[model samples]
Target: MENIRLGGGVLLLVLLAVTSLFVGVIDVTLQNLVDTTSRPQALQTLAESRIPRTLALVLAGSSLAVAGVIMQMLARNRFVEPSTAGTVEAASLGMLLMLLVFPGAPVVVKMLVAALFALVGTALFLRLVRRIPPYSPLLVPLTGIMLGAVIGSLTAFIAYRTNLLQSLGAWRNGDFSLVIAGRYELLWLTFVLAVAAYFAADRFTIAGLGGDVSRNLGLDYDKAMAIGLAIVAAVSAIVVTTVGSIPFLGLVVPNLVSLAIGDNLRRGLPWVALTGALLVLGCDIVGRIIVHPYEIPVGTVFGVLGGAIFLFLLLRRSSRVS
Candidate 1:
């Protein structure tokens, strides 16, 4: 049954990806796919815009999903992921700092700096969570959100003070419109991080059971957490640097997978990846189709749509418990 659900999710993701091919600000007809000379506009749209956007969507989705799974396991809280934990906000701050310090640094250099700060932020988050009593799983996310808000506010203040608000807009809004051959290279880094995530899945699952249980089971709890934090930071950095902050992706996708397939990380990772890809790609497609000539940012769509879904889930869970 788990395999069936997983397979279904994968199928949905593929369908979404294919649908993404058809969706664009410009209308692309079937004849356009066949006759390049006749439909030069369509050909250019598919080759330049749709393809890169689709790649960005898939990479962002899978990376964020996997980051969420690792983060939730490390924190022993389903709701604690990079976005909630201030990792993404910290990365944005790092990029801002790099910009301020260097004045004209390349994107790669900025991304590395952002990634380092993100790691630090995640480590701080884990330390904060450890200090808090774990009885209230809900409090974990609340604390994380508080931490993130603080960081986000600081970022906004800096951007405002530095008069870099326009520069920051690119990172604040998650859009794949800028992705191209040279620019999109960073997203592939997420693929490497995803592979590493799978290798450490067992340790994460053990750690999630609690530090004491993991220690008793002969797993290095601290080491596992450090590794998890690194993965979360790296993944969050890559996604934010590549496509900007995608709010609620890490929170929504993995939790949805957990609902369908228990809490087993190994068993649930694939589904999480697929569902993340599907959700983001589908949202991107919808955003493209809705505005016709202009495109809505994927982050905005996810913010509104994912928020509603999250609220529904919270309500449903509350009712079930009641």
Candidate 2:
């Protein structure tokens, strides 16, 4: 059954990707790639824009979801994700700083700076989590959301003052319309990190068992956590830098996967990755077709859906507790 579902999900993703390639203002078709008689413009759009956008979607969706799983494992809270935990906001701040200081720096440099900020942000969130009593799982996410808001406010203020508010808004609003061959390559770093997370899945699952358990099992609990945070930070930074912020993507996708499967990171990780990609692809497709000729940002679509799902999850948890 699981294999069937996985296969179906992959099939759906492939279909959506193909659909995405041809959905833009200027129509493109697979025939454009093979036929010498086809319009050169179609082939140019496919190679330069559509293909890169599709690849960015896959990389961003999968990596962000995997990052969320790793974060949940490290934080011992299913609700905590890169966006919720202030990592995304921190990365935004880092990018803002980079824009203010080194506006001409290469994309790689911006990503590195953003990632460093994310690491600090994740560390701070973990510190706050440690200080809080773990009586309610909701508390951690609420704290994280608040933390993210504070960071986001700071980023906004700086952007506003610097006359870069529009730039900041563009970065905050996740859209792939601008993605092209040269622009989205930073996301490959996220792909590498996601693969690394798969290999270290066991350590993450053990770490989720808590510090004492991990230490007793001869795992360096702090080291495992540091590595996980670094991975999450890197993924967050790369995705935000490449395609902007997609809210609740990290939070919603992983929880849905965990609810369907279980918290076994190794077993559920691939499903989480696939589901995330599918969800994002579906949302992007809807965003494209809903307005027809115009488009809504994919982040806007996921924000609404993810927020509703998040509310439902919270209510369901509350009901179970009650």
Candidate 3:
């Protein structure tokens, strides 16, 4: 039954991805691919724009969901993710700083800088969580939110002062309209990191039990944490640097997958990835057609959906506790 469901999900994702290829304004079709004359433009659109954008949707979706699950493991809090934990905000700040300081820097340099800041920000959030004598799940995410807000404010103020607010806004909001073949390659790095996370899942799960417990179980808790945070940072940075942040993605997908499959990260990870890709692809497709010639950003569409889901989750949790 489980296998059946998983297979169904994969099929759904494949169909959605196919649907995504044909939904863009340029109107790519199989007929275009078959006909000798129309093949050139259709192939160009698919190769240059549609395919890259679709790949971006899948890569970003799966990787962000994986990163979210890893973060939840490290924090032992379901609500904590890159966005809430200041990781994404810090990464965005790093990119902004790079753009300001070294306007001529390569994308690689900006990505590296953003990853560094993300690592530090994620580390700080974990450290703050550790300081609490007895941690509360609610409090952990709230603290992270506050930390992210502070980092975001600093980033915004810098952009304001430098008169680069427009540039900052572009990188801060998740939008894939501009993605093309050469541009979105960075997200593949994120996919590789997500795959690596699967291998490290057991250690991360043990480590999430807390330092002393994981040590007694013969796991190097610090190493596990470092690996986890590095993955998170790199994933967050790559996404931000390449296509801007997708708010609540890392949060919503993981929580939803966990609710369905339980928090066994290793077992549920693939489903999380598939579901995420399906979701983002579906959302992007909807955004493309919902307004016809003028398309809405996938970020905007998913942000609205994810926000409503988040509120529902929060209220449900509160009610359960009461």
Which is the leading candidate under TM-score? 3
* 1 versus 3: better TM-score goes to: 3
Go through the candidates in order and give each one's C-alpha lDDT.
Answer: 0.84, 0.90, 0.90
Shift in Å, residue 97, candidate 2: 0.8
Residue range 1-322, candidate 2, lDDT tens digits: 9889889988998999999889978867677756787768888888899899999999999999999989888899878898899999999999999999999999889999999999999999999999888896788999999999999999999998999999888778789989999999888888899999999999999999999999999999988998999999999998888889898888888889878888788889999889888888889989999898999999999999999998898888889999
Tens-digit per-residue lDDT, 112-140, candidate 1 = 88989999988888888988875666788
Query: How many Å off is the CA of 142 in candidate 2?
Result: 1.2
**TM-score, cand. 1:** 0.93
Clashes of each: 0, 0, 0
Taking all chains together, each candidate's TM-score versus the true structure is 0.93, 0.97, 0.97
Candidate 3 structure lDDT: 0.90
Runs with alpha carbons beyond 4 Å of true place in candidate 3: 133-135
TM-score of 3: 0.97
Ten-residue stretch with the least lDDT total in model 3: 130-139
